[model samples]
Target: MTTPRRAPRRAPAALLGGATALALALAGCSTPSSGGSAAGDGTVTITVGDRPSADQAAARAIYDRRVQEFQKANPGIRIEPSETVWDVQTFQANVAGGTLPDVLKVPFTEIQALIARKQVADITDQLKEVGLADRLNPQTVKIVQGRDGRTYGVPVLPYAIGLFYNRALFEKAGLDPAKPPRTWAEVRAAAKAVAEKTGQAGYAQMATENTGGWMLTAQSYSMGGSIESEDGAKATFDDAAMRNALTLLKGMRWEDDSMGTNFLYNMNDIAKDFAAGKIGMFLSVPSAAYQAVVINFDMPKKDVGLTAVPTGPGNDNKVLSGGSVEIVNPKASEAEKSAALKWIAFFDLGKYINQEAAVADAKASAQDGGAVGIPRLSPISPEGFERYKEWIAEYVNVPLENFTGYTDNLATVQLKTEPVKSAQEVYAVLDTVLQKVLTDKGADVDALLREAVATVDTKLARAPR
Candidate 1:
């Protein structure tokens, strides 16, 4: 019944170097004696994760209320909750310690691996049972399924890669903060101006760990390139588009001296610096960056301006899509699994489909001083989300307009998925490539890409078919 303090947002989980294997999907050890809907006593107990911790008092209050409300509606289910959140580094340990929450959220990056390890339950039947099989978003469901066509998780929060910029820096550099860079060329120009005029790192990059590769992938997608070929069996970054992307970074760092002194920033490093106004423009989605800025780094909320990923010359403005999925633990008892599904349904999906719930949740978030109405890519149909918006209209608190540049392209921009194989490994290797290119004046784009291709191909060959 007591809440723990919230840690600063855990977006750095993206930069973790290795796959968590079976651990990432584990809810606990072995199936329980109790079974779903068929428990002899007709009662089910389940453990859920991401309980807001003590750090978010208002959000925690709302979460607790929702749990009570859910139990009231589903009289047969009893819930045990934890503040345990999904973090890649602790994943294996959590599983080893037999503490993995029965129903927890995980990122899209782990879906394929979870399915391969059979760590998560196949929730296809449950989806059908709950009527969510049809209501789920089609595009995201692809990311939630296994190679055998079974559903492993339910996609909840999907986001597109966007350019995160310091609006105050833009104004100081004599640039229009409202009009962010529309193309890579514009980004280069803006970096130069911010560097010379403001004497700050006009641009920054997450050059360490998997983030280097992650950001590179986003850049490649923006520039109409991909790190892997369509078959997902080989490396494919040794081309002009990718080469051009790195070349731009090189120019900004060496020619313009626009990038900051730090060449080893991961998500955490970049976020702290970006939030402190030491950097101008970088790439990230809004939520994580905003959390770090306003909540962690203590930056003013208005300073965080976001825009869509700057486009490559020939690409039609494609941005990488990402989000977490709600997956049930494979080891859970049938009853526990069923209870977990219901928890997910009521906790996440309920807000989207139910008018009063949406309004109430939004109001609670606003009261918690949480950012609301920050536009994001959703896992529901556009129409469904629009209707949900109507319910929360009055409680909208986040200055959504700060993200006009990012949201303006939502209707027209294309959404791209992560590479199918060895994404973490590929990104880890790419990290070195970004570091070398950004820090080494003579860094050869062709040679670096060639070396990366060889490394990535070796890793991809080990990927599960």
Candidate 2:
């Protein structure tokens, strides 16, 4: 069965466009008057974003229940739920308008840029005092932190790109679906088998939009390539790791004849094809694998399988990680900030530690027919995350065993964030390079790397610090 696709997520907003947004935020924001004491007086009122819209009946019901429960548990803290959520286009405008929720959930990609732009608050001390400092998933923490070691946001759900494989194709190829490839050599063999047996694209890639560069970076990391300098000042991908990764792709496409003829693919398009069984394996997150491919694409539940991003000769074994994180408004008062942290601890962080809350959350997901039991990179210790998973195990709807190859190794692999300076711009440039390499048999990898690096370096030089 096939289903129509849901609208793709809004693209990340251009870096601070429109003079009015800058002018409004730069002019200063309206501050919320502090009514309650900073020390747990029931008087502090805080606004939180990401309230489920009324259209999302099941989710909204759970959200309302949680809000009421939260307000009751912490009487001294009054909670205000905002329908205002993150959108790339209007986020900065909201920031500029000073109309942002005291606590807003934003993408991991925005954390560094927001910090660099002075759009979010520095809550290092507050997080430390609240004991979240020690417990935060160290891997996810790296993405939100500044060079000074201050964190701008608290990661709510972190995920690493994994190989989303079609189990039916694997079975048809006489390969083990649960045991996904660990290295490039293994991937090559599996791709060959899947293509030869199923007459499908054994391994496809996201080669359009900025996603092309995004996946390329991930593949490059598996081969130990760096895209930029530590200070986010220069290009660093013109090396062996970069070439080796490209060479491997070249072999898969031209030599082994594994990848299919179609080269144009964005994240959404590829998910649809993967779900339709036209493709065997691709890079994606659990949400994409479960929601986009399985739920929306109507793929067989058991046919969808996953494993960690494959590793190569690159920088040990590491995966590129990303997810949503909550940040506080810079204009919020000290009491407001404290109250905001309390709300975050209660909402985002609380679910993992509180048994009732965990079970309720999972049950809500199950009731909503949302995919439950999708393994992911935790924003806390892997062990703690596993325990939380067990707490809600009864509600698990997806096949957990299929994801073991990815989840079991989360702690052992190094989690790498996107390029620090002009990350989107860098990806855009690399997108062209990737297209060139895949489309032209005679394309020179070294020349493409040097040209792309030069372009990225120039953009970095011109970027605002």
Candidate 3:
């Protein structure tokens, strides 16, 4: 069934223009006090970010209703909602100028830096007081914890990078739609078969800008390689895992000729083409790519298939993961912090424990024509997630069977976050290395990797301590 598209759950960064936002933040214009004010009558007022814009009527309606409900439940707390979202260009400016909301949503990648810079509040005590600490998924919550083991944010929606394939294309190529490739060897064979049979790009890799590096890191992790060391002190991609991954891609491009002629695919380009049935399989976040394909490009819902990242020589269950975190302002007053955490727990995390919330959110999303119950790595424990699924089963709109390859394998998956130090710089360097290997048949993988290592090491060295 064709469904109308809804605004992404985590609003895109484009809601506020970058340059304009940076200027406004730096100028302290429209800046709310970092520490929310307390009224004489004991009302704790906290401003929250990511309030859906009016254009997204359904989402905004749900958000507004939730705000009203939260306020009604907690009579001593009041919410002042804002449309401000996390934009890379404005994030630093906002932090420096103290223009941030008491509660805001940020990506997992930024949590480490925010923690190091003391720009986010430590909520270890708060989480415990609310009895949320023990209920959280230990692995998923690690992304928002500091080296000191203090929790700084609440993980909302965690997801692992997976392989997105076209079931229709698989059928056309005489491959099993239910059993996607689980190993590199199988991927190569499947790509060859799909290419030979359907004359389309059997498999494609993103090779443009940061996405090139992002996918390269994901591929390396799937093969048991890491891009940076644990402490972020050194580059670690110059190992056997990385070499093996590149070698496989080189062979696919040069020998199997399964990859399409295009070697400059970004996230959008790859998703567009994949939806058009020009490509068979590629790596991406299933839900994100699903929206691009089924919503924006009008691909049939039954045609999309999402599965875990195929294992390789490393044979480990490791895969890359990223998600959004709801963090309290570092400068928020104790009262504000308490209020903000309560709101986050109610508005963002109540679904895992509250059946009413789980069903309400699912029904609202489904009514808005949003994909509900797409497979994902949950922020809550396995038991909690299962219960949540059961609670919302009646409202789920996405085809559950199409996601079994991902959902059924969650027990064995180990999620790793993006590189912590100089992540963007590291991605930029790897982007060059990935593009060189994909576009040039004679490219020397070792030499390219060595150069990338040197560049990333330099970046890591110059990074803030």
- Candidate 2, residue 168: lDDT: 92
lDDT of candidates 1 onward, in order: 0.76, 0.76, 0.79
Best by TM-score: 3
lDDT of 2: 0.76
Clashing pairs in 2: 42-76, 137-379, 223-314, 224-314, 224-315
* Count of clashes in candidate 1: 3
When 1 and 3 are scored with TM-score, the better candidate is 3
Residue-wise C-alpha lDDT for candidate 2, range 1-465, written one tens digit per residue: 001112332111111111112222222222233553334333677788888799976666656666665655555566788898877557778987988889988776667878888889888887875567777888788888898888888998777878889999999999988788988888889999999999999998888777888888888888888788866889898988788888888888989889988888987789889999989889877665578887777888889888888888954656887777899988877767776776677667775755655666676657656677777777786667778888889988899878888877878778777787677889899889888888999999999998998899999999766
Candidates in descending TM-score order: 3, 2, 1
Error of 3 at 318 (Å): 1.2
Whose lDDT is higher: candidate 1's or candidate 2's? 2
- Point out the worst 10-residue segment of candidate 1 by lDDT: 14-23
Task: Compare candidates 2 and 3 on lDDT and give the better one.
Answer: 3
Candidate 2 residues lying further than 4 Å off, grouped into runs, are 1-42, 50-69, 79-101, 113-119, 128-131, 147-150
| Better model by lDDT: candidate 1 vs candidate 3 | 3
Tens-digit lDDT track for model 3 on 31-68? Answer: 12234487766678889999989998876766776677
* Model 3: CA > 4 A from native: 1-37, 51-66, 82-84, 87-99, 315-317
